[model samples]
Structure formats: structure tokens, C-alpha cells
Target: MSNRGRDTRTARSRWSLFGPIVAVGTALAVIPLWLDHSGVLMGVAVLGLAFACYAIGFNVIFGSTGQLFLCVGALAGIGGYGGAILADTVGLPVVVSILLATLVSCVTGGLLSLIAVYRSLGVIFTGIITLIFTLTFDALLLGLGSLTGGENGFLIKAGADTFLRKRIPPYYVMLALVVAFLLLHGLLRRSHVGWAWRALRDDELAAELAGIDVARYRVYGALVGAAMLGLAGATYAFTEGRVSPTTFGFAQVDVVVLVMLAFGGIGTLLGPVLGAATFTIVDEILIEFGQLRLVIYGALVLLLFLFLRRGVIPTARDFVAKRRLSQASAAPD
Candidate 1:
């Protein structure tokens, strides 16, 4: 086959993979119709979307550029508290506050990435740096209780009268954010940015030798991902009408987000959404177990790691590819 033909085939195959993801992802919009009668379930769905947003952003940083950002919750907390302070204390509009908070997260993420690159820190060291930051953020939340409401958190008065607090509207709002995050990832995956990320992730040294700006691309991934995390956290906090240290605590939020992305198939576009949906339901079911929830969680995590290490999506893709290849090899051709 000609080089042009091969390139065209590769592009077509790449896009075809997203057809299912986009279809199912957007189909989440109609979830309200089914759960309209149950505010509790609908609320869970909204939380699921928020988690999905975090996982997607994490994927961009970790899956794309090999940055193990252990402080997903800390960065997201920045957005949540940032939004609360700006909207309530500073008297900014809710939308404006959320946007500004997202930018703050973006800048923070970029700075972290830049520092890692400048210091030539490996993945583990970079994670340690972010983990310390997370611990400090948790401390600040308590030490500066007047502004953050300390341990108890505070109500969101700014958007209370808006539809944002409505049970169904907030779900749709978060759903929209998830779709937009997915779309953004798709755009990056198709562009030269995606190319740089693939190269950088696969082999940083080779990527540098091949003329890719490793530092710049790494920073780009973090900035975009952190923006998504911030926007999701801030918007969800305001809509839920509460902001507390526990809301974005590393143990509560970051651990769950990590599990979701890992189970979803990190680099794949739909992994975060798929993983979030699966775990959200799993969590709801685990609620019935009361005290055994932790045990069940451990069991489930063990099973996931043992059987689906590459995650549901990547493993399934590998299976389908192998089947097709075998059939082609056995054919008359």
C-alpha cells in the first residue's frame, strides 16, 4: 500500500474508535428522565460526573505525559475554595468565580510541572512534591477556618437562588462539563499536541531527540488537566451548596479519582467516564454493606487489578484487535 493510503487508514481507524464513546457519553444527558423521581440517585449521578472530570484531567497529565499527580484533590480543592472565596467574599459572580478558580488551578498545575522538569525529578519524586502540597492544603483549610469554615465547610449562598442548586439542573450542568472535557481530549489527541504527548509518554529521551519540547508539552498537559479539575470541583461545590476540607480531601477525592482512571483505561478517551460510572454504582451498592464497605472496596480493587489490569476499555480493544488479526491471517487472502 502507498504511504498516503496507510496514513488515511490509520486516521479513519482512530476516529472510528471514538464513535462509541461519544454516543454513550452524550446519551448520559437523558439520565434525568429515568432518575427524576429520585433526587438521591440523581445527586449521585452528578457526583459521578464530577469524578469523571477529575479522572480525565488526571489522564492528560499522567497518561499523556507520565506525570503522576498525586494531589488531584488538592488542586480541585483550590478550585472549590477559590470559587467560594471569590464569589462570596469578593462578591464576584458565580460564573466569573468558577472561571477564575479554574485559571488558578491551571496556573498551579503548570507551575508544578515546570518545577518537576526544571529539577529533573522522576515520577516518584514529583508525586512526593505534590503530596506534600496536598497535606499543606489540608492544614490550611483548618488553620484558616474563618475563611474556609474549617472542618465543617460552608454553604454556597451566591448561587442558591439560581438553577444551579436545583436537583436536575446541576446534573445537566456537570454532564455538559464531562462532554466538553472529553471533546477537549479528542481535539488534543488528534493534533500535534497529541503526537507530542504520545512520543513524550512512550519515551521522553527519544521524544527530545526527535525535536519535541518535552518540558512545554508536559506543562501543557498539566495546565489543561488542572483546569478541568478546578472547573469541575468549583462548579460542583457551588451547586451542592457546601464546601469543606473533606469535600476535596486527598483520601476521599484523589484516591477515588485514581481508581476510576486506572479502571477505565488511562490513555483511552472514554476511560474516565466508564470507570466513574462503574465505581459510582459500585459505591451505591457498597452502601448497603454498612461496615463492610471497606472490605468490599478492597476486594473489588484486588479483582480489578488482577483481572483487568489494563482496564476494561484497553483490554477489550486488545481482544477485538487480536480476534480480527487472527481471522485475517486464517483467511484465503
Candidate 2:
């Protein structure tokens, strides 16, 4: 058998054990509905799913492409505004608004990618550019006070989906999105392009030596990541019944996106999901501090950086993989 085929088979085998585990875990999610405060539990589930989607997109740029773009929240904000404008001002249906918003986000994300790739900006430079873009976008919203309601933010009218209106539907919708994202992640990870991405991420020069178009792959990753974030943002906008420029500013952009990426594990598919959920819950629990929330959040991120540098998901995954390998090696041939 060819070495590539062998590698593929090995990778598949390594992940096979997780299939049943995931299924079981998914089944367990339904148990929350049987509880008394199912409403809040459902809210947690939905929020977890949404943030997971955001994390996956963040990983596409930071994890797969070896690049940094700190405008995740800003891009998501754009998408939210795009949807809101379509629904409110243009009188379009919510579904149509969502579709258009997603398309707009993808186009914007691609444009960013083209510029970044063409300029050959390093990681730090890319972050700076994106950060500036986010700030500028925020300012533009403020200046467009007539349309965006200035600092007041905009809200959406009620819809048929009680789940969305309350929190249950959004949770299920997010859960479905998570499933779709995992499928996409699996497909990408198993493809030749996925290999190219990993190669580029590890060493761009070496990847180029191996015939990978580093710039092209990087652009692809950024677009894909941005598209996901756009989708998530559109959904979040609908769920919250509002969109605000302030929510997508620099503070929310980097700390939440990157911290989730770090706390969950940077490279793995599950990292962002796990990290986002963890951070969300942590933030809620820390909210009683009123003003100390940010301080505690910073400290938590610092602790993760100093100790669990690779993040929890990646570290746990590696440990389990190793243990399974050891067990398999010890088994009778």
C-alpha cells in the first residue's frame, strides 16, 4: 500500500474510538430538557454551540493557517448588522437576511485574505491590520448614527421560532451547526489540502519547498474561517434580537476568540468548541464581581498560557491517544 494511504488509515483508526463516545455525549445533551430549569440549561447548550462555531472559525485562521487575525468579533458584528439591516431596513425576511449576510461576510473575508496574502504580512502585522480594521469599523458604525442608532444598538422583531425567541431553538440550531462544522472539519482534515495546510502552518518555507502554494492555502483558510464566523455571527444576532458595534470591538474580538483558542487547544478541531464553552461558563460564573470579571478572565488566560500552553483539549487528546497506542501495542498480534 502507498504510504499516503497507510497514513490515512492510521489516522482514521486513531480517531475511531471517539465515534461512540461522541454519540453518547450527544445523547446526554438531551437529558437537560428533563430538568426543572430547562430554559437556562437550554440557553447554556445554545451558547456553547454558538461559541464553538466561532472557535472553529478562529482555529481555521490561527490553527490551520498559522496566522493571526483579531477581528473575529468585528467580522461577526458586521454579519449581525448585515442581517439586521436586511431584515429591518430592506424589509427582507429573516432567512433571506441571514443568507445575504453570510455571503457578504465570505466576500469580505476573502478580500481580507487577498490583501494579507499579497502584502506578505507576518503574524504581528496581520493582527495589527485586522485590529485597525475592527476599530475603524466600530468608528464607522458610530458615525452612521442615523442608521445604526449610534450607541443604542438595533433590535429584531419577534419570529415564529419560540426556541429562538427564548433560547431553545437557538440551542438546537447551534447544535446542528456544530454537527455540520464537525463534518466539514473531518472532510478537510482528511483531504490533501488539509495536509497542505498543516505543512504550511508548521513551516511555510518547507511547505513551499514541498510544492504547496503557501499563499493560496493561507487565503483559503482565512476565507473558510471568516465564513464560519460570519455564519455564527448572523445566528447570534438573530438569537439576541439585536446587533451592536460595541459588542464586536477589540476587547471582545481577541480576548474571547484567542483565549478560547488557547484554553481549548489551538490546533485540534475540538479545541475551540471546548475552549469557547469553558470560557463562556467561566465568564458567567465570574460575573458577580461586577468590575473584576475582566481581571479574573485575564488571570485565567495567563494561567493557561503559563501552564497548559497547548490548551486542555489538545493535551487531553494527546494523552488519550498515547494511552490507547500503548494498549494496542501490548495486545496480541
Candidate 3:
């Protein structure tokens, strides 16, 4: 095939891959605009979108690269608090603060990746290292009582004059972020760096032998994932108008994100969004269950893993494709 023909084929493949994702995202984006104007539903949707973005970032590292950086919540907290401090304390503009906060998260992620990847730590060890960071960061947030407001948490005054104070704006912002990250994930999946990451993920030793810079790609994954998580955190702070240790701690960060990614279809483009949406709705419904909520939720998630190990989206995709193939085979030529 000619180079042009190959390029055309690649372009078509890319379109085929992302077309459904884009269509679904568009439909979801219009929900808040045209659907019921209930504050409760709006709030749930906003939270779901924000976490969807966060889960996507987490998926980039753990799902795509097979490196478990479990401190997603901590990274997000850094962004949320960092943005708040910059905007409130230093009096920076909200946009600038958000950008700086994202940068900080990226740096933190890269540093963590350096420790995890450059050190050539095994998967379990990497998770342990990130878990330590998450715990330590939570402690740090509490210890910085004046800055983070400790258990009381700090209110975000920035963007007060803007639409961010309202639920709708934040919801739209989060939706936009989720869509952007999904697109970015798709692009990265087709890029050379993505190839390197996948190569490393499949077989690190073999990838290294093939001259792929395993450490560099790992760091790249960390940086990209961290940046997205940080952006989500900043949006969360803006939406809630507060930053608390609990919001970005272990429960919210590690467990929630992992569950979302796993349930949605790890490594798939639409999995994080689907997972985040599904669990967020579940959370809303189970909120009234109080302590038993966790039990019920855990049982459900366990069932999902037991039955559909690859996750709902990927498994469904496989089933559909297989059915189509069988149908084509049975069809007369």
C-alpha cells in the first residue's frame, strides 16, 4: 500500500474508534442543558463528570501502562488546594491558578513516577509506594491547618464573580474536561508514546530490548494522568467552593477511581466515563443506605469483577463484535 493509502486507512480507523465516543459525549453534554433542572441531579452529574476525568487519568497509568499510582486523590487534592492557595492567598486569577495547580500535579506525578518507574519497582511495590504517598499527603493536608484549613477545610473564593459559583457552569466545565481528556486519551493511544507505553506494559524487558525508553514513557504516562487528575480536582474545588482533606483522601482517590476504572473497562476510552457515571449514580442511590451502602456497593462490584473481568464496556464490545462475526459467517456470500 502507498503511504497515502496507509494514512487514509489510519485516519478512518481513528474516526471509527472515536466516533461513538464523541457522539455519546455530545449526548451527555446536552443533558444538563435540556433535562430536568433539579439541583440534586445536576450536582450528581457534575461529580460524576469530574471523577470521570480523574478516572481517565488513573486509567492512563494503571490500565494502559500497567503501573499503579494509587495516589490519584492526593494528586487531585494538591491541585485543588494548590489552586485555592494561589487564587485566594496570592490573589492570582482563577484560570492561572488552575493552570499552575495542574502543573504542580504534573510535577508531583512525574516525581512519583521517577520513584516507581526509574527505580524499576515491581507492580505491587509501585502501588505500595503510591499508597504511602497518599497517606503522607493526607497527613500533610491535615498538618497544614492554616493553609488547607485542616479538618475544617478551606473555602475557594476564586471564580466567585463568574458562573463557576453556580452548579450549571461547573457541570459544563467538568463535562468539557471529560470530553477533552477522552479525546486526548484516544490521541495518545494512537501516538508513538502510546506505542512505547503499551510495549512497556506488555513486556518491560522486551520493550527495553527493543530500544523503547521504558522509564521515559512511564514518566509521560504519570505526567499526563496527573495533569488530568489535577484538572479534575481544581474543577471539584471550584464546584464545591471548598477543599477538604477527606474529599481528596484515600477513599475518594484510591478506592473510587480504581473501582470506576475497573468497572468501566480499564484501558478502553469510554470505560472510565461509563464506570464513573454508573458508580456515581449508584452512590447517589445508596447514600441513604448509610453504613450499609459500602457493603452493598462492594458486593455489587465484586460480582462485576467475578463475572465480567475485563469490565462492562470491553466485554460488551467483544460480545457485540463476536455476534456480528458469527452473523456474517452464517450469511450467504
Candidate 3 segments exceeding 4 Å error: 1-11, 33-36
Task: Indicate the residue-level lDDT of 119 in model 2.
Answer: 97
TM-scores, all candidates, are: 0.95, 0.88, 0.95
| Candidate 2 Cα deviation (angstroms), residue 88 | 1.1
Model 3, span 1-333: residue lDDT tens: 565687788888978878977897888878887544788888778878888998999999888888899899999988899999999999999999999999999999999999887688988999999999999998988898988899999988888778987867788888889888988988898889879978888899999999998888888899999999998898788778888888897986679889888898988888998898889889999999999998998998789888888998888988999999999999956
Tens-digit lDDT string for candidate 2 (19-127): 7336734863584576327766566566666778888888888888877888888777778888888888888988888878888887787788778889998988888
**Model 3 worst lDDT window (10 residues):** 28-37
Give the per-residue Cα lDDT of candidate 2 at 260: 88
Query: Residue 103 error for model 1, in Å?
Result: 0.8
The order of the candidates by TM-score, greatest first, is: 1, 3, 2
**Cα lDDT for residue 138, candidate 2:** 88
lDDT of 1 by residue, 94-198 (tens): 999999999999999999999999998999999999999899999999999999899999777999999998989999888888888988888898899999999
Output the number of the lDDT-best candidate: 1
RMSD of each: 2.1, 3.5, 2.0
Q: For each candidate, what is the lDDT?
A: 0.90, 0.78, 0.88
Off by over 4 Å in 1: 1-18
